[model samples]
Target chain A: MKIAKDIKELKDAISKFSGSVGFVPTMGALHQGHLSLIQKARAENDNVVVSIFVNPTQFLPGEDLDKYPRREEADKKICEVAGVDILFMPEISSMYHSDEVKLKAPSYLGYILEGNRRPGHFDGVVQIVMKLLNLVQPDRAYFGKKDAQQLVILQKMAKDLFLPYEIVPVETVREDDGLALSSRNVYLSAEERERALSISRALKAASRLIMAGEFSSEVIEAKMSEIMKDIDVEYIAIVDRDFRPLKKVKIQNSIILVAAKVGKTRLIDNLWV
Target chain B: MKIAKDIKELKDAISKFSGSVGFVPTMGALHQGHLSLIQKARAENDNVVVSIFVNPTQFLPGEDLDKYPRREEADKKICEVAGVDILFMPEISSMYHSDEVKLKAPSYLGYILEGNRRPGHFDGVVQIVMKLLNLVQPDRAYFGKKDAQQLVILQKMAKDLFLPYEIVPVETVREDDGLALSSRNVYLSAEERERALSISRALKAASRLIMAGEFSSEVIEAKMSEIMKDIDVEYIAIVDRDFRPLKKVKIQNSIILVAAKVGKTRLIDNLWV
Candidate 1:
């Protein structure tokens, strides 16, 4: 696989490819979730491009940006083994500049759930995603459903900005224990890892409630909250596909979300019914 | 020229053209300045696409949004004569949606001079321009230099976003009497028209001062102020190309800008030395 370490090299490599390009953007330390996205891209397009840049703007002041995982050697090996045509690894300086244009997420939708906990996080996310989309010019971009809100916000941004690419939403890759995979999962201690299972358990409980024709969000939220009561639960929300609050869940259109802190690490999971 | 009144039509027409596309996005009030931009686009690329959408996001609540000029028939004729291949005229609903992501201008460069006079104006400009640029996906995009700061800001945004198109900065078109051409010039009455001449005249005087080796902005601004004393001058600013204030003119890198109100109409002009 060809590697581009700078913008010029990436642009040159991208220019040489005329076929449909499938892109998967990640922040290094490739996990099974990222591998699933890359594998989907590899299967769908003539050229598959994967980018690994731990964007600093997406992290708030007190966020875990400095301690974010970075395993470049392992990530490169995984991309090559996955048959990625090009791997773009740009420096932060090439990606951002001081006193430049900034993006703002939607006020109402962007300020709920994860956004409420991390204000201005979606703005940074939309900004970096936009820059990467423009640079990649992919025919299709793959994103896992693990970051449900992020996926929805990115899909909205692509439509609102008139970007000409399809956003392929892949299902969240989970462990054998039903724990949703995440890069931050590495931050969990042994006991915390065991506790993190509560998140998925809560989501599964909600899914079961929905499957049994119990669409009342209040009852489902109560049960989910009870399941996650052992941890430091932040919120349990039932919303539509657009992130609008729904008092009662609409099957196939509803999303049941949960965010909580397992020990010191924060974790989130959702079930799209 | 083919007219596309919706996004689907525009995309269909754009997809059929396989050559280099040069785009000119306007607000449907074609003047000499816009014609000049179209002419340059025609000269450079095999295909020329012109969009005439009076973007509502770019206009403030009290701005001239409702009263903005709309001469679609005339604009169509002008584009046909100018050899434009595609004319995209999408509805506001087609271009934007409720509670979606938005773009923000830089706090430092985008909030001075014009941005100061009209807050959040550049934010709107950047947002709409980004949408239009992404939709057009042209090989080159053209903008008149009369809106110097707007051009600079757009260039910065395109670069910052890594958009794959060249921003061709066309010189501002002027009349024989030295007034910069603008669609909004029609808002001026006979007397207001005559008074508005002070803007260009003051710029000319500043140019002469620079020619005569007057480098200090304080000395030059004082003289220009004297020339525009009769008008309701809002501001007389001398700054670098990046919109930062300069103590003295840097010859090739300086810009002298003026904004004034004449009988309820606001006008702006600038000279790039």
Candidate 2:
């Protein structure tokens, strides 16, 4: 496993590798969910490259940027075990310059849901993703469905910019108790961890209601919001595949999402029906 | 020369050509300036691609978009004589989609001079240029230094986006009367044509002043503005190569630019020292 700390080193490593390349970009603190993505890339492509960058621009002030989880040695071990060929770890200085032109996330789509909660978040995501995508030039990239909107926007970027690659979306990994896998999960204390499961529980309730012919978006959201009564819910939304809000859930085209603050830690969960 | 009307066709031509590609994007109505670019591209690159797109996004409402000069037959003849390998004539609809992500010119640099007078102009220019660049996939693209800010900003975009192509800047082609070549010059009547020479003459005067050890930017700008007294001068300013206003000319780093409305036609001209 080669470790590349800069773009030149990464490019040299990529040149050494022959055949198809698969890439996975992460914010470090790898868990089973990230490992799953790496493993899939390793299996599908002749070479797998994983980038661990804790992007500062994505986090607004007062957001958990400074304290965001970082397990460098463990992450390296995980990548090595998952058969990653190249591990790109860039410093903040190497990846960005002063007053550079940046990618702005499309205003209409990006200003809703997670984007609203973390304003300017996706713009930073798109900016870094664009840089990473161009540098890696992978045949396919792996993104976990845990960040559904991010995955969708990255897909849109690829298509919009005519980037030559494919986005392979792995299903969201979950804990036995139904809590979605997230690096932020480390922020939860025992009691907070228990309370955090309410997010998944609410999403499960929505899924069940949908399975039982409850297609009305308002009723499902109302029921989900009721179940999320223990926490400070930011939003309960039912959006179409394009993210436009719909009055009724159209099967195979709808996603029910919820965002809530569980003891000061924001948790988001959703199910596609 | 082969004619391409869509991305697929353009990329097809691009794929077959392995050597360096030189590109010139225009809005038809082939003039001496465009011919100069085509001739230079032909002389330098293994293949030459020219795009004639009367980009709608770049034109404001009531800005003569409908009556923009487009002499297709003459354009083809000019390119053929200039040895262009491929001529790409794309429809505006073919290049852009509804509700798409867009490029914004730098807020600080874009909203001055030409941008202030014609807001959103550079955004549209950057937007179309990006699409054309992507479609062309040229090893090197050419832009005349006449559109100095546009050229500089495009270079910034290429660097910011990690676009792996060189921006080859050619000199601005001018007439015997010192008027910079422009398609919009067609909109100038005979009297306005005589007045339009004021832009180039002011730029030349600024060049002469700076060369005579006049270091103060304010002094140089005042001299240039005085020369364009008859024209409705929008702005006469001195900026560094990065488009930031400079207090004093830093020899080789200073740029004196002038924009004026001569009759109904707006003209921009600049000199980089």
Candidate 3:
């Protein structure tokens, strides 16, 4: 696999491929979720490009930016094994400059769940993704559904901006214990790790409720809240595919989302019904 | 010139061209200035595309959005004469949606001078330009320096976002009377029209001052302000190419800008030294 550490190198690397290019953008510290995206990109396109940029703008002042995981050597090995044609690892300086254009997250859908907890987070996410998308000019970009809000917002932006690339969403990858894989998962202590399972369990409970003809949002949220009683539950929401609030669930269009703090490590999980 | 009234049509029209495209985005009411951009595009590229979008987002409330000039037939004739291959005139609904992602101007440079007078104006300008740029996918885009601040801000955005297009700056076109050609110039009464000449005259005076080796920005602005005394001078600024405030003229890198109101019509003019 070729490694491109700057924009100019990445552009030259991307220029060599005339066939369809599939891109997967990550923040390094590759997990099962990121690997799955890379594998899918490799299978789908003639050229696969992966970018590992832990965008600083996406993190709020108090967020875990400094402590974010960075296992670069391992990430490189995984990409090489996964048959990534090119891996773009750009420095922050090359990606951003002071007093340049920025993006604003959609006021309603963008600021409801994950955005509510961290205002302006998605704006940074959209901005960095735009920069990367333009630089890569991929035929299709892969994104894991683990960050559901991020995926939805990016899809909206790509469509709204009339970008040439397609946004292909892959399902979230999880551990055998039903814990959604996240880089933040490393921050959890031994006991805290066990406690994180409740998040997925709560989502599973919500899924079961939907299967049992429980369409009321309040009832499903109540059951999920009960499953996550021990953990610090931030919010349990039922929203449509567009992230608009749904008083009652709409099968095949609804998503049950949950956010909670397990020993100071915040995690999010969702189940599409 | 072929006219495309929606995005789908525009895309279809654009697909027929395989050679280098030079794009000129305008708000209709075509004047000599816009024609100059189109003529330049025609000369420079195999395909020339011009978009006539009023772009409502760029106009803040209480601004001249509703009353903005529109001369479709005249614009079409001018484009045809200028050898434009296509003219995209999408409806507002086709270009924007509610709860969509938007762009923000640089916090400092974006909010000074013209931005200070109409806050959030550049955000809309950047947003629409990004959309048009992506949709057209031109090899080079033409922009007149008459809107000097807008040109500078867009240059910053294109570079920061890594957009795959070259920004070709066109010289500002003026009338025989030295008045900058603008659609808004129509709003001026016959008497007001003559009074508006002060804007360009002041810019000319500033240029002459620079030629005579007067480097102090204060002295230059003071002389220009004296020339524009009859009108309500909004701002007279001397800044470098990047819009940074310059204490003294930097000769080759300086821009002297003036904005003022004549009989309720606002006009802007600038001189690049």
Candidate 4:
């Protein structure tokens, strides 16, 4: 209900809370996925803080940073309706300085899937998350499983850096058509929206293949590739919970991740099997 | 003092404390400088935690990491005497992972002066410090100003990353003869020890110049250099609090830093003017 536009106000607002704090950090234009994270946080903690920062550092030079969706009034209404104790919307200038310490994602794991497509993207993610975590100092921080690679990297960072908070991953939220909800979904044209469904369809097909005892990564990936033959598939990887490549899927520990361009808007989705 | 050798143990030990914690992170040589930091921490907070980690990442390949002083017993006694509540000494394996998130010090500020002499050194410093700070989660973390550049870099990191704790800058402790107390001073032979005193002596000469109304940085650095002519002076820099090069000494806001080698040992010292 309380909106904090700066660091000092946020700190002051957070300091008044005596119980455990749960945080959900997101870029603006609250989607169903973000709402799920906030709802989870709301249910889990005495104080729920939501930060909507479209961090510039996370976007590469050619990335759609400028065009990123901003629905501040709507986001505020969503947070209020969701019972968020505090909503933090900090200016970019306040969050970052010209020359400051930066974080580098793990050399091997960071540069693989999403990182390969968008170099230095995870670095920016790690940097902003670190700042947000430090500022919020939440008991538990909610991150959706939709950004599987990001979730894994953040978990690794939290452990490696000795961050004293739990990274609670909420299940990915999907539409009735099995399409994962993303803010970037707004960028899709009417026809492109229909094509984007193929991504989830491919993932569903991979799931069915795995359910039918096709554990071989190559076979599943081949089938997944076939499912989205018309779409621009960037990669379809089978990796363990830790993001290490697996030749064969290990049920309950494996994730089939897919990334593709649907009409110039890159989308990523994964299924935990 | 309770000695915690693992993360879980340290966390449990820290969890029992309900008061403010002040921390001093060191590499366990128990020198006067370190003692001063621990003493300051003890004085400032309800609980004091000291960590003795000879972080290998901070040391370059050819640098003296293995031979770095590790007087565990003596350091323990010093911490106990200094009223430290907990002393955490974690194994290298426990503190770091093979492939994990790493910190990069600001490109420009990190790669200059001492950073220039030892590339990637500040990165390691920031990385380990970040880990230790997160693990301890102290109210205040203490650092001696003897390593002026390091102090500045860490302060920048704390502000930039929005670390919740305060970085307390403690005054540098020195021997009666004016040698800045350092673990590396152990490597100095009797003859080499005498030569190392010139580092502090040069700083003193510069101070005397400043006191005598000689504000020109170039003139003061030239004098300081002349005083340490016998030693291999790595650099003689006069910079502002933020590490920006100063044309003339800005009273109450400038630092004169010195680094030199005596025999095979590298030593650094600085003066806050």
Q: What is the interface RMSD of each candidate, in Å?
A: 0.9, 1.8, 0.8, 0.7
User: What C-alpha root-mean-square deviation, in Å, does candidate 3 show against the real structure?
Assistant: 1.6
Top of the candidates by DockQ: 4
Per-residue lDDT over B30-145 for candidate 2, one digit per residue giving the tens place of the 0 to 100 score: 99988888888888889999999999999988898998887999999989888898999977777876566667787866777778878988888877887787677677888888
Q: List candidate 3 stretches off by more than 4 Å.
A: none
Which lDDT tens digits does candidate 3 get at residues A1-273?
A: 999999889988888997999999999999999999998998899999999999999999988899899999999999999999999999999999879898888998679889888998999999999999999999999998878899999999988888888999999999999999998899999999998899999888888888888899998888888889999999988999999889999988987888899988889988887
> Model 2 - which docking category?
acceptable
Better of 1 and 3 by lDDT: 3
Candidate 1's chain A scores what TM-score?
0.98
Interface RMSD of 2: 1.8
How many Å off is the CA of A234 in candidate 3?
A: 1.9
Candidate 4 residue-wise lDDT, B76-136, digit = tens: 8988888889999999999889798999999988999999999999999999999999999
- Clash pairs, candidate 1, are none
> What TM-score against the true fold does each predicted structure earn?
0.97, 0.92, 0.97, 0.98
For residue A202, what is the lDDT in candidate 1? Answer: 89
Q: Which candidate would rank higher by TM-score, 2 or 3?
A: 3
Best to worst by lDDT, what's the order? 4, 3, 1, 2
Docking class of 3: high
- Candidate 1 to native Cα RMSD, angstroms: 1.5
Q: What is model 2's DockQ versus the real complex?
A: 0.46
Q: Score the docking of each candidate (DockQ).
A: 0.85, 0.46, 0.84, 0.92
Of candidates 4 and 3, the better by DockQ: 4
Please estimate how well model 3 matches the true structure, expressed as its whole-model Cα lDDT. Answer: 0.91
- Comparing 3 and 4 on lDDT, the stronger one: 4
- As a TM-score, model 4 comes out at 0.98
Model 1 misses residue B44 by how many Å? Answer: 0.6
